[model samples]
Target: MNGAVSPLMQLLSEVETLKKQIAESEDPVLKESVGSTINAIVAYGQEAYSEMTQILDEFETFQKMEGLTEEQRNSLLAQSLDHFKDQMSDHEKDSFAKSCEDEYKGIWESLDGDSQEFLSTARYLGYALRMRGRGNYAPVINEMCRVFENELKKKIYNDYIVQMTQKQVVDMDSNTEPIKTAVSKKKKNKDYFISDTEMVCFIEALPSVKNNQSGYLSELKKYLQAEKWDIQKLSDSQYTKSAHNYIDNYRNDSAHANLMDEKKAEKCDRQTHKIIKHFIESKK
Candidate 1:
């Protein structure tokens, strides 16, 4: 029954509790202040934890020095610990310790009696560096990533999904119809929402599209190569059909009379096809 706790676990518990209390608070001002404080605490806790881990990792790297000794390591640790401590206020430091404690408590509560002793061991390991009073985080950070690359990847992916979900929700509620239309299209055709990074990757994967133009040429080349995409291959009758689709897709002429009178050659996708046909013929 040896009980030990981590600062991170403790901080997280406080945050959860504070969040609950904030939600129930009678005073609006108090609730707002509590929420803001909780946010700052959590933000600082994460940043400090990451920085401390990185510092430890760097110190570990220095351990390889030709004349590195226990005394040297302790001295460096002590100095770095003081520097990190000075970077935060007493309240922030306490918040960080509480976060670790909350994090450890969760793990301990989740375990069965058979492995209860593991809680103390895990907490000891988690808090050992903090107890050591040092801030060489580089080695610890590097080691953690090397050991948990998959976990890191999962975290990154989860974060991206959360962000995109929020963005999509907001886009749906936007007052601007243009933005709403874009959002609807993105929702309908996920591929159309391809991020700039994904688009670049797609273009690079298409080697044949490698004209002097960047990825733009790649996409253009793709369209040119498609069986249904070639303008020259299309008959005059097909052009008329495509022009109608283009106008129907882009032009908002709901009335039949409007469509008849404003035939300023509807253009758009049809015009693009004509331009591409000219280029293709010139090249031939």
Candidate 2:
């Protein structure tokens, strides 16, 4: 193998060259044997590539630990072992953040204007909360909730307006009272943003609107529930109760911040991403 090229890459390259050579050969039996061998080599190369990728991920994690003193690093390592056992190292948190970013970057870029704005902000905050420590995660998580609710409120309100407009124009006589009532209600709440209670109402009202879907809110609820998150509490109002609790109990504590303990931050980070990913997927 070449010194510069990875073993996996070298094997893959050799397999391709062998495949080309076998394609032009006259011996059928030799071709079949060599083709089988190439297939085996390709599979092994794929496994090697996966292993190397994981090693690279770990190395990247290690690089992030460079600035800490030995005692700090040892404490971090000990804490990680307590939470994650031998399977996880100090780099796991960073790895998780990086993996989520890489996996969803393309999908996030493809979102509609409002969705893109909300998700991009959420992702940035989540990354910051996980990777940086300025006691900013509290405010960031709060803002994340606000952004999510604001975007959802806009979507629901616009959808409702479109439905009402169509009904008013098409079925003028029959829908006159309902349209008048809806318009009055909307006009009365001009500055209203959906609170958790209002979000539940909006979701309940979705089935009545033309082109409105049913699965989004339900799926979001299910996802949160499966994660053991407090969905009803999250949806009862705009604030993320769990996130606020963490901020109040841990992040805001004077001693905790200087310790550089990331367990609480990691939890909030993951939950924020989960919420963002679920919202994006539901919209799609």
Candidate 3:
């Protein structure tokens, strides 16, 4: 009869066995306690299995790529790694980034190049997984990808002059009349490299905002109201109550319209929310 038992049937049978053992015990109190414990175990198992089924269903919903082949994936992986490897002097340095290298290569070898965009697309998914520590973030992933794409485009534009200056065709001598005009690329003034110490300080000084609906909104509001946004001052705990309406208005303004895709906007909101939480935790 056991030869054809389903998984649920097997678990139920085990529970029945436990119940029988508990019922047959000589000690009355011991029997009662054992029965209670067995019931709890069965209940816990059922709940855990239900949650696992829900997670599997959700995992199945991730965007699937069609027309991708294992060979093409391997080719792209080799190309990406070879391009990076060519820049390195020693195999040791190249091998130092082994995990990243192996993951990309393995992924490529498993899939095809028809889904070339998936390389960039998967980045945020990986980052969010690492950052949030494994949970549901379907909409968040879409938003992060949108933000990453925009940032990449900005980086390309910002590096254009640097790339040209390094080319052999470009004139370095001031005395000689150059065939092409000297391109002076404007430095983007953005605070991307805030020190961890400053971040910690900011977190410690954060007001006692309850980590609820009001807390999330309030933290974002602090960033929106920030007057200078200077990295140096980020570490200093100052009492400056700024309006979220101002930041919210600025977020909606046409000046930032170019960056305001629905996905990116959502991501931006989430990032801000996280920063606030980070700040609060650091202060503690």
Candidate 4:
């Protein structure tokens, strides 16, 4: 029989053996490390660590089959293990795509079908979760900001612009006039930028029992002929504020920053999810 063995198989075997020994040894530090290694392997999805054991067991059974020669058995054993790995790889991708559907279980139930579809397709949340699961926090931080900025763009565009033709948007009302002037006259030909702080102020200006016709919301409703959104969501809420602060604090620096340890990563991940689910709820 050929003695050649796959390096990946050897490494996985070492990890499993180390995991088992650490389990029985009562060394908290080693056990913690082993758990972390397993988690890294499972970034695609859970059960990857268990999948290794299942492959080994199947290969052992295949090795004992009577018909094949020892050489054939060894070759087939490697093939079986490789096949299992391939299956796991494919399953990992499937898990990622599927998780995009409902991983934000917190707000999934609150969204309408269209809202659910939009949030699911956002993809940044999925990317961030995958990074966090792999013990990588930098991409997670970026994804969190991506959720905020892109969703805000989507909300404004779909809610307001889609309803009007180009001429109507410019000629329809006085509210859009300032927007037109800002876009055309700004230095560097810069477009008007939307911001979370501005949103907070705008929401505060929305008509209440006292004032009904003199605010950003009222003017927006006039020119754009736009309907109200989940206005409460656009307000200065804990989730919204945190999401804004997360973008401000991390987005610029995360690219060149050092890797965060698990504790920091955990906090980052939780905040990312908070931002994602909050946006999901805010979707109109």
Candidate 5:
């Protein structure tokens, strides 16, 4: 969420101006011009503003008092989805289990503020039920797989930042096992390989945001070899290459294809939730 410019600020300024303008403007063409200009202002704030009307719009009301914290904003998102699922008569044969209600609340709250914000995109994103052509199954699977991979990156990057703070690994190195072993065009089978694309996306995509990503890949490898971390601990501080292998293989088969049906969507979400709990468990 863009806390710098909240929805309440927009309402106080832009909405009031629009109301005054609408009252004063008598000509239809002039009113339409004014309306379009206000709409354009909303558009410039963020493209997601259009799609996430329900969740994002809530900020306008609450931000009047004070802007939301990362967790509060995420809670709002979770609440919106949960409210709909519970109130609206949606086909239960389509929704993902543990992705709603108290189950989701626990998972969402378990994460730290930053991690909650990082993972909240899963809440409002990829409305598989809304996908017209592809049906509900494929999109749900795709979204869950995507969230899993991104969560891994976030967790690994978070650990990497901590290591830098403590001067553990080279002040800027990350010990991560990527989703793919090789940087190939193919993601379907991917066979067995490790690629830096996932970590690179975090490190290089925005230097200001990922300030800890300073050292080269070679430094991390050198540190790992010299320190001799066990394979289980070496894997993004979660599990070994085998865990990564299993995830990659499962995701490859589940996502990137529309072969699965609606029931599989629930299965994907439920199974993913279980594995993510393991991934986020605090390692001693």
Candidate 6:
């Protein structure tokens, strides 16, 4: 039976056994207290198992990858448990943290390159949330924009450049001049490094590298649309347009004044997470 049963199933079976024992006991008050306790345990276990199932479903793709081991699966689960730590009791948090940390160093090592980066970014976002909770909102928002612009945007721009120039073979003396001129023009016109408007334009210019679809552009446009942002009116660098605008506004306002409050910071934190999730999903 043990061999055939899943861990959750085994837990449920144990709950049933406890219920049976309670039913057989003769002490009325003892039965009442123990019955309530058993119900609570069963409810908690069911909730935990449901969450674990959802996490496993999310990682189903990872599990299908070649060379994944049982040990890696367990580690992945532990790493995932970190996200739910806040919802757990103090005792559960302690136990979960201890288990996760034992194999924490190897957790990312066991994942694929993309998975590793995804989880690392997510962990960083968690840190950003903690910082926001501690009332360090400006720095966290600034860092979020920096990651979006410098890391994600720069990566996409460089990849696009490589893809566009991949087949060209330039001569050292003659042909190289045109290639250099083109690159210079692309950089000047795209100007993604300077501001969010240029970054949006740069993203718009990029051809889709996957299935004839630009996932990054699509995801970004959806976010901008939801924010009621008009791309045409975003020509001015000072204008607040995209989610990056929130970062810029917060930075500028906070530098000269104490304008950032906890509520606004929490909203910014949520927007940052949404932006990060878009970047992560686009990579997939």
Leading candidate by lDDT: 4
Over 4 Å off, model 3: 1-17, 63-284
Tens-digit lDDT track for model 4 on 1-284?
01122323345556677778776888888788888876665452345445544654454466447676433543454454344425433434344335544556666555444433333322332332242354434433433344455555455633443233333232444534544444344433444444434443444444341334443345454432234455556443565567557755654334333453445544655665676566665546
| Ten contiguous residues minimizing lDDT sum, candidate 3 | 250-259
The candidate that achieves the highest TM-score relative to the unseen native structure: 4
Cα-based TM-score, every candidate: 0.26, 0.34, 0.21, 0.44, 0.36, 0.32
Q: State each candidate's clash count.
A: 37, 0, 4, 0, 4, 0
What candidate 2 gets wrong by more than 4 Å, as runs, is 1-103, 118-133, 165-189, 204-265
Please provide, for model 1 over 1-284, each residue's C-alpha lDDT reduced to its tens digit, 9 standing for 90 to 100: 12344455577678988988987889999998898889888896778667766654544444444464433543453344334445444554444444434444433232333222222222233354544454432222222111111221232222333333345233222223332343355455532222212222322334443455433333334443542334333223454354344334322121111221112222321342342233223222
lDDT of each: 0.38, 0.43, 0.34, 0.46, 0.42, 0.43
Candidate 3 clashes between residue pairs 3 or more apart in a chain or in different chains: 69-112, 73-108, 203-279, 204-283
lDDT, candidate 6, 124-212, per-residue tens: 33333342244433333332334444443344445444443443433343412433444455656642223443454444433332333
lDDT of 5 by residue, 63-111 (tens): 3334654335334434544333332223321232224434555566554
Question: What does candidate 2's lDDT look like per residue over 1-284, in tens digits?
Answer: 00122233456668878888898899999899989989899787566445434533332343256576433543443332222212222353344334444645755453345443433343443433333233434333333343344445454444554344343233333323433455455566543223333344434333344433223333334434454544444343343344344334432331122332345445555555555555455442
What TM value does model 5 have? 0.36
**Candidate 1: 10-residue stretch with minimal lDDT:** 254-263
Lowest summed lDDT window (length 10), candidate 6: 1-10
Misplaced by over 4 Å in model 5 are 1-101, 104-106, 112-136, 158-242
What are the candidates' C-alpha RMSDs?
A: 26.3, 18.3, 22.7, 18.1, 17.0, 16.8
Q: Clashes in candidate 3: how many?
A: 4
What ranking emerges by TM-score with the best candidate at the front? 4, 5, 2, 6, 1, 3
Candidate 1 has what TM-score?
0.26
What would the per-residue lDDT of candidate 3 be over residues 1-284, giving only the tens digit for each residue? 00112233345557778788876789888888877877776896576445544432333232232353433332333343233223323432333333323444433232222222333233323332333244433332332222222222232222433343444443343422211232222223331222122223233334443334232223322442442233223233431112122123222231221223344444544443333332222221
| Superposition error at 235 for model 5 (Å) | 5.6
